[model samples]
Target: MTAFVLVSGPFTGGEVWREVAARLEESGAEVYPATLTGLGERREAGGPDTGLETHIEDVVRLIDGVEGTELVIVGHDYGIHPVLGAADRRPERIARIVYLDAGLPQDGDAAVQLVPDEEVRRRLLDPADRDGGTGWIDPPAADGWQRWGSTAGLSEEALARLTGLASPQPSATFTQPLRLSGALATVPTSGIFCTESGMSIAKLEGLMTLGMPQFKALADPRVSFFDLDTGHWPMLSRPDELAELLLGAAAGEGHRLAAAPAQELPGYLRPFVLDVPEQTRERIGRVDLYLPADPDGAGAAGANPADAAGANPVDAAGANLAGAAGAAGAADTAAAPRPAVLFVHGGPVPETVRPTPRDWTTYVGYGRYAASQGVIGATLDHRLHSLADYPLAAADVAEAVELLRADPRVDGDRIALWFFSGGGPLSADWLSAPPSWLRCLAVTYPILAPLPGWQGVDSRFRPVDALAGAGRLPVVLTRVGLEVTEIAATVEEFVAAAEARGTDLQVIDVPHGHHGFDTVDPTDESRAAVEQAVRSVLGHL
Candidate 1:
């Protein structure tokens, strides 16, 4: 069984989590609801001397008092401070940190710094300073309380109990900067976002736009985000749903995702077949759309689901189409169309091994990863080597693009095209005159021009020849510095040409990595590099 330690925010006591904790306990979790010193029943002990360190000590003591190894630390609002601090101190014992409508802070960032809006800060802090100096901060006015409690959907008596039980917070807690030792980053984390929190989401987005530290902390690859429709207090509004999300996270489901369902995300393989008259194969080619979990409609915020397919895209063959197509089709209909990524795999293999849905296993995982990160992901099956050269393959890409653009669940104008390995040559036409439907181009360890294996091919296969006309489309390239591939010289040529043309080309070099590091090496470095590349591509979308 899992042991959950729930920490409440400023002014609120552990009793506020009574409903949520009760539900967790019913589900067989050993729950410990913690009240920080001076903010709950211990209000008399709080003063100017009670800083963030004191609050952290309070939680560390509770964690030490716990009985089990599967410790999950949960923080709500201001409780994030102590919870994160304690988790940093005991990463060995902690299983994960569940941020429940909480503020995430970086090392050396004070609570005040985490608050992105000046008006709101002034509204909360100015009055506190004027009333009681730095020792304690008083609660907000009546209307302020109403607004904060509005989405909680509490009964009159429950609301009264909440308002009446609120206590003054120690001012030092807000001013004290968090001091971390890189320990917090190692722990698995999940965020249960209250969509009704009018301020936090906007603040986070603003930080991300500015490329700040707090934004990076919240957007770490290890963190999973789940949106709840209720306001700041799900304990009072949607306790059962909150409990289920916590339990699901504790069970290691939806562990590292941008957005996931409160309940289990369904396992479905969906294919979006492209109906273009390229006139080649007997069967119509398809780009499998790897979507995230269907919204449970139990206050689930976003429509992001992950997909399933196996093997490297080049090695995917002999897949059973009949067995994979029809399960849970009804469950996938309501997913709102999102920003998508169109994956173009490399390889100029024999015409007999032309692209197929099953052949895109490796790339499909990338698409699935995109869906997990709140974007729609689709992997295409284009013509192979001798089957059709660059120009024809480019046409196949265009047809697939049209298919994606016509789909209701896709943000057509914001789509990205990712070219892997040998598929890079087919991107020349897109780079020369990028369309409005294209957001950016991501090329990884690519064959930018006709190499030894592809010498004397059609003129269209030479991507380097068209770099001067790459327009202004942003291109993120992942370079493998270790392997000496035949395309190395051509890739360098492409880089120089693209730079001279002022193309927005950003190259990330994996110094000790080989070609296809993501699929071949699959080490921690490989995973990190893949995540970085994935993040870069999604940023354009």
Candidate 2:
């Protein structure tokens, strides 16, 4: 049978791919999500550091069967670490490598240097900082992150089990720079962006405060890109769309969007989804394109994912239209440089949607924010048990990382992550994984206490404890309330605890300040706090 392996990101296991895998199988692709050591139910409580190499071995061993089986290696979020190594070791056995909104090693790169979300990098590597080359992990907090977070959609139950499903990813995973011997250089690449276009409070907070970019960028030669309207947890919010995209891409048919024709319809304006260019006919890749409906089907020659939904290409070949008026056309409006802000919404309840695909939210915003002082922003969609996915929201966040990590405009070295409420715990857990190219960790109103009786939350690795003490990467935090007390009360308590813990913590209590006040009202009391958080990160970068 044709072989495909789905790798897990931080705060997640291979089970998250159940639906996606099933869909692929239905379409005739043998798929399996790799269960690495110390992950999921079969974790490694007492083992060596589960660095990138360890996970790579697990994937390599899983596919040790079937001669000449082309391995379609799919990695999500932190899972990108292993996929890169696997690609290096078994490039010939693998037909293609799909990022699934996951990060990939750039030129002569390491997982630590892949994408530049500095904040996220610190969180993932927190464990490594405290531990001495040993395995230390933070528990997944998918529920806490969604609950107290300003997210727009989610059920209470899904919030409860956020951490329970997650295992402590080895601390070495982040510290051990990924050494791909040139895997991606020769493999076919595809990227998919899950956009959570919502008017939720939590999401709005990320948009304004963090200043994450609205649009993402891509410049790799062997890559293809696409965009979908969903949260960080697309599997839950937009599973069918995600499955369709994933399956089509695997078989080489993905979102083949194109620019629509100019007069095909009345005055209509919309953003064209961005993605990589299509390569071979058998390989499908996506990037949003608004191809106006052509009466003569002029632009139909681009690509399609079959009859399900064909790509509409506008007929801009001949006649003079809009800006495409024949012999030489030019003119446009542009903007400036602001730190790349990845607008990460709190949880399932809401998603932080930005304006477009041209900023910080893409590739962790190091290049823009660090050198150019530009901002990259993004929104949230992936969460537990919101629409379809349960206990997989963390993986979705990882997917977002993958999507933005390779953005052409983003400074992979200075990327960071921002979150509050229900997303706080999840963000903390991710931080516990290992260090990435990221530089700092800015958490507002995070969930420090564990969710009791929440079967969904589990912590095989104590990420916070592992990250505790000296040597741990920098962790900047701000809490609006305590884990169990009033929201404002909890924020105060968290701030205090953060200070005592030696973390760069800041908590605010605005009379009318709630969970997402910062995001919705950028000029509100939380503005200074958010600004401080962003600036503090810049210090290290």
Task: Give a tens-digit lDDT track for model 2, residues 446-490.
Answer: 544332212123342123543453234566665442122423343
Q: Candidate 1's error at 48, in angstroms?
A: 2.1
Native-vs-model 2 lDDT? 0.47
Identify the runs in model 2 with alpha carbons over 4 angstroms from their true place. 45-48, 66-68, 107-134, 143-162, 197-222, 255-541
Each prediction's TM-score against the native? Answer: 0.45, 0.42
Task: Give lDDT tens digits, candidate 1, residues 1-541.
Answer: 7999999876788898888889999988899998888877888878778889999999999999987576989998778988888888989989989888775565765665333233434443465443345476666543456433334555667667677878887777877778888887679888876766643343344323222122344555667767677777778778889888889878765534233232531111222111111111112134466654445634211322221332213223423322232231233446566787888876554344423433443565676577667676667666654412455567778777766666555666899998877688888888777787788899988878765312224555567777666677889999877544455677898889887778898888887776666655546676778888888988987
Clashes of each: 8, 126
TM-score of 2: 0.42
* Highest-scoring model, lDDT: 1
Q: Give the worst 10-residue stretch by lDDT in candidate 2.
A: 325-334
